[model samples]
Target: MKRISVLAAMACLAACDKSGFNYDNIIDDGGSLQYSLLDSLQVQMRTVQLDSIRTSGTGTGLVGSYADPLFGKFTSSSSFRLGLPSETDPGLKAIYDSVELVLQPDGHYYGDTLPLQRFQVYQLSRPLVLPKDYDAFYSHQQFPVNDQPLADVTQRIRPTSGNKVHLRMNQQFGLELFEKIRSKSDDIKNEEYWRDYFKGLTIRGVDNSAAFRLLMNDTAVVMRIHYHIVKETVEEKTIDFHMNLSELQFNSYSYDRSGTPIAGLTPGADGIMGETTGNRTFIQPLTGAVTRIDFPSIAALKELGRYGRIMQAELVIKPDNGTIKNYPVPPRLTLTLADKKNVVTQGDTISNAAGVQYGNLVTDKLYPENNQYSWDLTEYCRAMMAADEYNYRGLLLAAPFSEFHTQLNRLVVGDGGSKQYRAQLKIYYLLYE
Candidate 1:
């Protein structure tokens, strides 16, 4: 009998008006059916520290350092091996002019770029190889480098201007490279020999430097050795070594959260409640920090009535005003299922009838009150309401994995107990006798 009544209620919902209806509106329909809207559900928010995520083969180079008042100091460095040039010989009459490392910006940056930033390039002590038991390099991985730097440069970076960053390399280094190709040594004859002779390089930014994204395509980042042929007109020639295999490149990131609201947060530990962290939660995937949301009062809905169904559920999240001035918010955000231990379940992302929800973001710079990220949580709420046992699973709000590994975008949102703009959950319920 209960199954038949549930099927009948579903049929009625399908036949009802599909356009839209006001909340709590009682449609007579000459039947004993009613609807109610509940928006006072208690929400719990927290900041969880995730384990190191894979950062290799992203095809983007990240280098620099920046200090954040809320997130502490963040630093990134890129490392990769260069391929052998097609034409190893620069001719016997070639006279070494100079060499420079060129980096093309990809128009992505964080923090202030007006100040002079310092960058240094170091030769790797060993070859670029994964660890014994590791399959891929993670954001926290690091490689040993030579003490002496090959190139050191300082300049104001303009990432979006389409200008490339050129750093003059050491003359001794360039001369030795030219000599190897000129003499036609075994080191310059093949890729493996060349890789062994010239292991790799690591580029890093000094402390307090702003982070910027650089193109890591086969031809984008290159080392060019310029030379002049002793011809009648002094003709010039160049040999280029590029970052050939995109999968060989990676970026390493580190962060210090000392003295911050989320201090002492670590992976595998229960997350810190937003109320204890100044009533706010943070989402910065680059550093493995994501926002956790829980519907603590969802089970209480059963007390309202025995035959009640959730017709719709909506979650609205608001960022604290004045939090995104220099640091831009991520364009899209998604939710994934997480266990009570704060471990995110793999391949359990949440989605609605329309597919994966990206939190339709509404930006309002003029009036911050209009800024919010809205998501449809109807299906998830229905499952929670129908569960016989109490559900301890929660959602982890974060950027997509692709963007999370490549970009350092961040967001600070108000929790349910925030004094200012707080997160809200609204559900439309239908009751039948």
Candidate 2:
């Protein structure tokens, strides 16, 4: 039994020797640990301003104005060309009676809705001409309108509650259109000539103190002319003009962020050049604003005595709950890498069928529980360490579907302060010899 005990002790020592540790080292010190935390390392944070994004008209919406006390005021206008009806022949002596314009909602809106909002519809003074390959349109593009409005409407509408806006139009103008179509003039018969004759229509918020959203798709904007024909018995018929693919269309949005928390922000500043004196960062949709992040200290990780493989890396951004109040937060937010010149370029590691970088924002329940956004950037950080490529350029944060949609949501992030709700980057790694 004593010899068996001695052999068992020898075997235990051999096992420890194979494992690169002795009993003393194993009990008192971690001799064969695969990883160790670089205790002296922490990321540095800085803020930069993002440039204005293109507000190209996509999806199905022509949004309008609304005001927010915290985020400031937002206004939008829609311009679209009209197409004539297929059935032009309503028999002889077609007496045009009335005309109406109908607009539908896409069930999305922001800000106060209790106050009455006014909208005006005007005819464009010139035709909306565009090249066949025009990819995008900015909010700054201008199309002058006639002095007289075709229609005006004022009402309290809750688009979120499945309501729409209806406006009575000018009957005299409707009658003129009917006459021109009946006569089959070149201006009325040819599509290009029709657009030249009618130009386009613009729907804008006139004297609105509140803001709302509407889905202005092919079927959203409709002009119907009710007329009666003296054929045997007075038969009533309606001719409709639709804003569809027959012509070019676009949406324009403007923001008056004055007298708000971010009022002093320079309009077009990009990156650290646009940093404000305050210790807070702001983000707004509708090409309003974006948050830029930079990490100079991340490059220093290599200076540590060891090299490591990044097992997990996360960027956690905490939002100021008080700033958002009861406003609806954006459903998703995006993180984009910057170029070598520190410019946030348009290339994503992932691209869609059209080759356009598919910018996917992290959309999940991480925001509501802790009022924060936690992004899993492990692969990104790993690539950064491996190639040392864009680790210095940091990232850009913006909302999804905001390039073309009129979303009024905004977020406030704590920065460079003693506040508990600040943005941070956390990483867990395994060290190597």
| Model 2 TM-score, 2 decimals | 0.79
- What lDDT score goes with residue 22 in model 2? 32
RMSD of 2: 8.8
Q: In angstroms, how far off is 215's CA in candidate 1? A: 0.9
Put down candidate 1 lDDT per residue, 1-433, tens digits, no spaces.
Answer: 1222333444545555444444357465765566656677788998989899798888899999988888888899999989988878777788999989999999998878889999999999998987899878998889999999999988888999999999889999999999999999898888888878888999999974589999998879999999999867989889999887678789999888898777778886577889998889999988989999988777656443334567778888988876878778777788776677766654322574323457857988798866889887887776666455434567888997678899888999998888677898877767553
Summed backbone clashes in each candidate are 0, 3
Over the stretch 386-417, how does candidate 2's per-residue lDDT look in tens digits?
A: 34653344566667644424666677766534
Model 1 accuracy (lDDT, Cα): 0.81
The 0-to-1 C-alpha lDDT of every candidate, in the order given, reads 0.81, 0.61
TM-score of candidate 1 relative to the true fold: 0.89
Number of the top lDDT candidate: 1
The ten-residue window of minimal lDDT in model 1 covers 1-10
